[model samples]
Target: MQGYDRLAAVMAADKGLSIFRSFKRLNAKNLLYLQAEIVNCESELDEIIEEDKNSGDFFREKYSTSVRCLKEGLGDETPKQWVKIRQLRELLDKYNTAALQYAQILRLKPPHAKDREVFQRWLKENAFCSTTAEFNQWFGENDENGGDLVALFGRYENVDALTRWVFRIAIPCFYKLVGYRKAKGDVETGMVYFDDDKIIRATRVTSTITSSAIPATSMIVLYLVNHMAWRLAIIVVYNIGFSMLLGLLAKARRVEVFAASTAFAAVQVAFITNFPRD
Candidate 1:
């Protein structure tokens, strides 16, 4: 499920996120600081220029050679006003860069990618997605209760999106399969309270079960077919399916999928080739 501004949805969600000050705090603070620094530098440089501009001997022909040396010193390309100009330039550069970054960061409505980063960080900090409040916060129609957001998995597109999907599916399925029902008034609110901790633990256990089952599932048919050519064909098919499944379920990158598939195929091929032919 995609997370949203559902800070309004739950009664007990992290209040820090609810009152997040990304715009007011981040952009305004940086902008004001940069602006002040630049202004101060401008004032200071103006004074330096005013003072030093007339004090130099370039106005006197008697000091022409000395002024030329100051102006054209190969040893130091910028001999006059260099420090002030550099400092001003660096400040302006910093301001320019911060402006561009803050444009993305300070929008009234941020881009989805930015939201994803923010919500995902919140999830990491508070473990939001695995909570009963999170589920209820985003479970259904928004209405006055404030849900109505898309589920956070693929849509928000955070880290371990697949793992989040697995958690969502495994939690409900675990309860159903176990057929555990609490007696009425057994818990707070007397409402159905999904045990997120147990669900997460169960999801991990299910993941462990899957780790045992998969990667090998692709090769199970390898031993059933005896002919060398057919076995080779099966191996090729297995590698393709294996790679696809790994990408789909693990959300792995192409390089990761390629590396794992290559490693597995290499080992499987070695064992098959070295074995007795049927």
Candidate 2:
């Protein structure tokens, strides 16, 4: 009775599947018989394998021997050569993928078709993309030195370009006004951090004034406008203090001293006219 009931259930399932819909006639009983045959074959195979304890080990040894033979074919020198070739290929693939990904990610626009092509070629050659900080710094410097103020400002439509111009040009101009060195000194070494001592000193002075006046040119303006008598007084005091500071801290030549004074006076004029403190 149980066998009949099981047979009926299989028949019902086969009917639901529409096994008779096929070109060949296949029924529930035939399928059940095929399943039993599979089980029987599996059981027999397992019993045969169980009889041979070393069968698993034999397969493992066989696999290891095959792998060893294949490895040995490459030879000692070939392995290193192959490894380097593989690594280079992998790096090339990664670099190409990275370039493609970077182009999509950066979405940079070129001025002309030639420029666009050149940009794409450069992207393919260069694997790395500029970080946000690096990109900003690059743009800032480019805007400053690339063109005159009017040309740069008018040519560039983006606010970022204007901001970059201010940072690169305006800030440096104000830095010159301060009695700072063109070059900065290494904290550990008294040597200039950049190029020549003179240039470094000049840059330092300009940067210092720029730093003080940044985001608040009005204060510097007020200081300048308050009194004519006070201007010479402040200038004399600044000169004495800065000269003393330079004498104590620096090993600059007499020519450097003269250049710094000229730079300071020029900076003061520029500050007074272009970037009035008030």
Candidate 3:
């Protein structure tokens, strides 16, 4: 019959549409999973990059102080001073290692000749010296000036300034050189899309609880006031006590949730680390 054929065709079309929608949903979920993995990888890389920057900053601070002392005729001749010098040297080495590792991890290829030349020129002009010879020459000229290269450039008011001008100057340059924008973009996106969802869900739940509580409280108050005026004062006190108890319960729940989330994160880390990688 014609009606039977039409029904059969309609059923087949519905089935096909359902299968197509399911396939699309699965593909979408797969894409989201891949995006999450990429974001996590970038976050880890950003943390490492931040560590490298911190090490570099530490090295610069220690190096500047040590160099200042040396220029001021405060030689590291004593055992204590020598130990400090050795520690500073170790930090410098650590900074260099971190920088190299960062560069390798980021796969930073050699810069263009023009860009390299420009950077070298900036180093010469701003840093007071670009090479070892120039550095030695500058230090030797310290007697001509009242202070050393750092003082000559007026990099800081004094040794106690701790906030190094050179470090501040280098930050923008390093940020560009390290290609931090990509990592920063991924982090921003993840925060907006992933973290925002959690925040929104919490807000909705809190709103629902609050909206429900207000009406319920009002109804209880009204019932007490109308039916039992004598016991109204006691009911009010009871309501206040119940509210305080609820507040404490909410606080405890938050603490428990925080602990559970921390545990889950730890387990995830352990699982990922132990899992075989190809």
Q: TM-score of every model?
A: 0.46, 0.21, 0.19
Write one digit per residue (lDDT tens) for candidate 3, span 1-278.
Answer: 23324323432432211111112333445555655655565566455445434565454335334655433333444323334445545655655565455444334223323323332343344444446554434223332321211211122222111123222334335556764654343221121011323433554465457546744564444444433433345345544544443443233354654564455335433433444232
Q: What is the lDDT of residue 179 in candidate 2?
A: 25
TM-score rank order: 1, 2, 3
Residue 218 CA displacement from its true place in model 2, Å? 13
lDDT (Cα) of model 3: 0.38
| 1-278: candidate 2 lDDT, tens digit per residue | 23324323433432211111111122334444555655565565445435433455453234234645323433353332233334455555655565455444334222322222322333234323346443322123334311111111111123232233443455456556752456664332222222223444564565556535532443354364656556556655655655554443344566886677666655665555554434
For model 1, residues 1-278, the per-residue Cα lDDT tens digits are 23443334431332212323233455678878999999998988677566555666453222223645535544545644546667889989989998887775444332243233444444444434565654444222332222222222232243244455544565446656763564232232222344444544664565567656755774566666678898888778877876776765565788998999999789779867777369
Of the two candidates 1 and 2, the one with more favorable TM-score, higher being better, is: 1
Regions of candidate 1 where Cα sits further than 4 Å from its true position: 1-21, 24-37, 52-159, 167-200, 215-220, 248-251
Give me the candidate number with maximum TM-score.
Answer: 1
Q: Enumerate clash totals for all models, in the order shown.
A: 6, 23, 0
Task: Return the top candidate by lDDT.
Answer: 1
Clashes of 2: 23
The lDDT, on a scale of 0 to 1, for candidate 2 is 0.40
**Over 4 Å off, model 3:** 1-87, 91-203, 206-212, 219-230, 233-278
Q: What is the Cα-based TM-score of model 3?
A: 0.19
Ranking by lDDT: 1, 2, 3
Q: State which candidate, 2 or 3, has the greater lDDT.
A: 2
Better lDDT candidate (1, 2): 1
